[model samples]
Target chain A: MKKLYGVPGGEVLELDYPAVADYLVQFLRRELAWRGFEKGLVAVSGGVDSATTLALAARALGPENVRALALPHAESSPESLADARLAAEAFGVPFEVIDITEMVEGYARLRPDMTPHRKGNVKARARMIVLFDLSVAYHALPLGTGNKTERLFGYFTWHGDDAPPINPLGDLYKTQVWGLAGELGVPEKIVQKPPTADLIPGQTDEEDLGLSYARADVILEHYLKGYPDRYVEGLGFSPAEIRRVKELVNKTHYKRHLPTVAVLSSTAINEFYLRPLDFRIELE
Target chain B: MVRHAIVQLAPEKGQIRRNLARLEAALAELAEDRPQVVVLPEAFPTGYFLQGGVRELALTAGELEEALTALYRRVWEGPLDLVIGFYEKDEREGAYYNAAAYFELGGRGLVHLHRKVFLPTYGVFDEERYLSRGGTVAAFDTRFGRAAILICEDFWHSITSTIAALDGAEVIYVPSASPARGFFGPRPANVERWRELAKSVAAEHGLYVVLASLVGSEAGKGMSGGSLVASPEGRLLAEAPVFEEAALVLDLDLDRLPPVRYDNPMLADLKSGLPLLLNDLKRVVEAL
Candidate 1:
């Protein structure tokens, strides 16, 4: 599949996950076995994506070696917690429930007028705080749970949902999450649950965004397929939704990049140079 | 010991069933030699389209059951396990995932299926829309060792490997259908970076790394092919020729590994904890 990280239409190399995980396991064990970490820690929200990550962690490190930290806010559904536990236990990993209701409440009460965006940001950040704390206490790397779908739309709070010491599942999309989750033995309840932020009560991700993930994903799929904008409009999406998403794509373009600085000198380094881009330049 | 091969095969444009058939034939031919384990590259069945029509080309877990399961059962001369890349639809769940399926010899059947976790967003790969993200991290049990699977972007992140190590994998195999890019430089030198990363990840974790890269062009991009097996010490034990198709077999002494982290004092120290000093340093730099 092609990825856009500032560069337009860059192709990504594909690897087999088990083989990659096998190699990765050896690397981590040799590097961190003596580091006193008894386990690996990840924040799972009962969603297929996180559940998949948790399963990977457990399988790669062993159930005992993997731990799930569920940081739920007051508005988060009870089923979300149940799903998280179901996934963790199914994978044979340890589970920890850290209700962030108090923290979210404290922040909300402290700032009653906080905008939804700001409140969402707080909820995400609060969850991360708990996750990081758990990681430190456990001496585990904080595994990130954001997927390609969320990352593509800039749907996550930076340093909040996106923050992690290391992310194993960052390259996958929302749809793929379900695929791997089933293979990894994730419970059906979590996989079937409609995608949600669970930041506020009565909020489904689609309702908040004014588009179904399926539709948004189809749009994204077509956009990546190199369809022109006019062709996209023929698909019967509301102009407003298209405009909002397109505006999002434009405005959030910067989110996909390292901050650009005015070149003060002749040579400015970029990931482009990691392997001479000249080689990648098509010969005339 | 059972010799194994993970071929990173990229097919000619728009030939899904044919390519898969060719793969099955090639694998069956190899099976005649009695290799115990085999792995194939990502999206090998439909090819890595990275764009539209992938959903149509993608295979569901059930659809794959007949082909892959039968292949494993039919090809087995001895104890063998196989992992292959395919696009899988979960009809029950009503979702599609970039999936890898595992089959064991003697008709053991459906060992595991894993989805690609890390979807790259920074390059010619736009996997975000084509596939859903997976949430689990674990190893598939293998006779060779406690093995695990990861697809495409999963290796870029360190977590997948690290967790695999702690879980008890002695060897890590990676199957890749990386589109080749022609370069003027020493191609091996170019591949050395990935080798270094893989070796470092392996050596630090003290496990063997086996990589299989796709040969030939797929769609428009060319692959830089050089599949190699590395030792726990990060030394190349055997390697397939670059930018071409070849199968390499090498003996690995799992016994040679340090046995426990005890042999590597660095491991113990690392486990003690990352220095608080580093966090402080990072904070200071961020403040600026």
Candidate 2:
């Protein structure tokens, strides 16, 4: 019998929910208001990550000021849509349902022989277009829903679910996100349901990744903390699984950062042109 | 064996009565467990980050004595001890010090006071402007063996713990009102750093280390609690929750401390080298 991460006998990683919630809520409210925004828009996918982000947004910007959108496609799950609706209603925030089947089909019509993976990307980008347009019209900042796990694995569509100006769940693992979802009073069904991208029919995150979040999170956490692969494997993970996870992380490294620009001058743009957040002009 | 309780609390800003009342409630809750010693976070009576109002929030020696006398009579029923942090006013010198005071249940009331030797004046701290520095570090006898208390930044310097251990202290109590910082993953990096600090002190000194940290937000700054206890071998025995008010009571087997000092002899090395180090220091000063 092997020890599973986050299980009864395994090492448990947990968040101080009340503290995190308060910090995130206060951070969201303060940072957005500092940037001259009074409202926030979240794309609720009926999954735990998006639902958790939506709840935090509502708590930060007041439910009346927070807006949710459920973009469903022909291959989308009906239960997911219902869950999204339940989340919006539970938070007392106004939400709209936009069917993106035809919109996505318009892009698919260009390349009829496109694969499901490409189609998923098109759908994801189309959803972002709608979200950004809504954000501009409503004068709300678009909130990101991608968690650390999906981001590390590059499981999300670049510039689609990943392009939100501000993300509250970006620092949380999928397993940690479930813990936060429960703390935020998300529906038990949504919290317990299999996580999905809803990009294609019958696609589940764990099934596609070939590892459970509970198992992968331990490896990912150790990897991020600069633990060696062998050390992570020593924690009861199979070598193949660890290698696969490391490869995914390495291959997707480009997606995690901005595109590099050729440096031609004494001071590079990123290094010197931009002022650091803590840089002070006047000493007190 | 000693049963100790670490109370991670959020003191109301500048509200001494309310904070004391909350402490009383927490003590009441712990009464059933009958912990012999209770440790509270730094500035437990007055909230941390008192910029210009340190004098206003500070308790004079007489005032502190009166308050502790009342509190001991009101709270304890037996031989209980307490270690708490507060802002102190030395009326004779008309100076303020960030201090920790130890009190026995029915004994001489305020038995010992350790004024913080290190005043942090950088980043979010501006202690030097409002506080007068203490010039000495020493440990005293306590109900829980020889014990010493260090308030917040004082414990950050390894020498403070070394000095206390050299002074025959068996246990070091660190009460901190540290703000929560850094989001690496699930937990705050600052809380993890505090745990490492406690562990190092315990391992190096071969003595028990208890750290009681403040929780909750004050003036938009969140204090990461996660109060914890470490054995002499630097093993974490129990930890309270972070960012929330929690009372943790753990029975520590003081008799089972490892002979780390005898085996490792780091303390002995420092003691043997002290005379030469002091003579060299005096020679350098004379030459300068």
Candidate 3:
């Protein structure tokens, strides 16, 4: 029930990072207590979001209970691995770095005409494979590193950075990520470095989206806050930018719900399936 | 093409050591086909338990690592990988986490670990009270194909599935330990959920989804064990029985599936007036 950041364009609310962290830990522990999971696996991207997760996970679960996986593509910055190692050391968790460039390139070669989007997806998925493999090795839950800001903007690769047993930071905004990093004592270097996917050379997340985080957050705030489209348009945004944001919101909207199913029968499966599985009534 | 098994076993309370022995026997049966991989249910060692004093039921980090390594090494003759779920404590951080650990046949010594992501706060789940949520999505490489995992709730969540598929997982394995509810009884709601989730996610992303669930009852909850495999187009390839423990084997031709986004083109076409339509729909529906 706790949130790390305020809704965009809404009144800003103060968040207790440690309290939030404790809440998250308790949530996982209780969930695992029910699910019966004790070990946890974290995939470290050498980024602020993942670093904060590692620290939180270490605090909630002992460092010995946690294992860190570092997955790198050949195109990944060299410092990426080093930063992930630094995070692992800080948490005193076991760490391993698996290079996935070869596998990704092999797939690209098979589909020689693959687009940049497809190639980017390959890199993302390859990293996921490494994480699951490690999860298997350590018998731990695979941690998800995606934050709310990225999910809101549709900035992540499907299935790759997205899959995990639990996502500790799904609700946090990018800025709140900074706040948590400071509160958790994450390295300032990772916190300050330009946020890039490192998917390709000289490519950053903002450049790919053709907008800054500041503007995107503002636009997202307006949209999520129920501001009229015209009112948001009146904020001196470009026609193309407005269109892009609107398009992203619409296209990725499906990402927000359980897939919709059309109903024709009197006792429709949709009505029955609307509830989460665990919430369903007893059979017989 | 590869042969894989989704093993649904009965997990009992306070029987980590014994439950693992039963799993060892299941592996023995699955190994006959010389399987490339075997996917087990979530928290196979100890059945799902949310009541008080459950933390003591979790295994120590060292015991978990040693036991899993030995199991994978002993059961598998050829190249094999096992994705198993268990409970472990982080000694330094002084916290508990719900984790899935991987045992690669070789001495990889813990290839990856994922802390559970989407902890369900409502219903029979009170995960918020016990475990810490994981923050990173993870994938792995294997001889069969690229793989990744989503423990239980992560499979139900959208972004988690999207990230795994987008990350290049030819096959994504979901190790689940969902309880059976009476309303959706006879048919496991979790199985249907996994079926729907796999269909939507795989069709949208173009990948195979393998869901392995724990069968039988543990403590007060009955697990909805219906291990199933779905193709990228959302086709049901194979599935195991529900309520009872069994291993569901499936063969996937990763090469035959069409590219999810490129070939289908629905996601790509959303750049048009799709947003306006959806927003209007949301407004109309919510207003009423």
TM-score of each: 0.47, 0.57, 0.47
Interface RMSD of the candidates, in order: 16.7, 11.4, 17.3
Estimate, for each residue in B109-149, the C-alpha lDDT of model 1 and write its tens digit. Answer: 67778887887655666677656888886876766567777
What are the per-model C-alpha RMSD values against the true structure?
24.5, 11.3, 24.7
Candidate 3 shows a clash count of 99
The DockQ of predicted model 3 stands at 0.01
Q: What class would a CAPRI assessor give candidate 3's docking?
A: incorrect
Worst 10 residues of 1 chain A by lDDT: A273-282
Grade the docking of candidate 1: incorrect
Given the true complex, what DockQ would model 1 score? 0.01
Error of 3 at B85 (Å): 34
Q: Model 3 over residues A1-284: C-alpha lDDT tens digits?
A: 88687655533423556545544554455445545567788888888888988888888778888888888888788988899999899879899878888899888888878987778788988888878887777778877878877888778876678777577777677776777788888888888888888777678878887887767666776777677768777886766776777777778866655467788776565453222222211123
Location of the lowest summed lDDT over 10 successive residues in candidate 3 chain B: B181-190
Model 3 residue A116 distance off true place after TM-score fit, in angstroms:
3.7
Best by the TM-score measure: 2
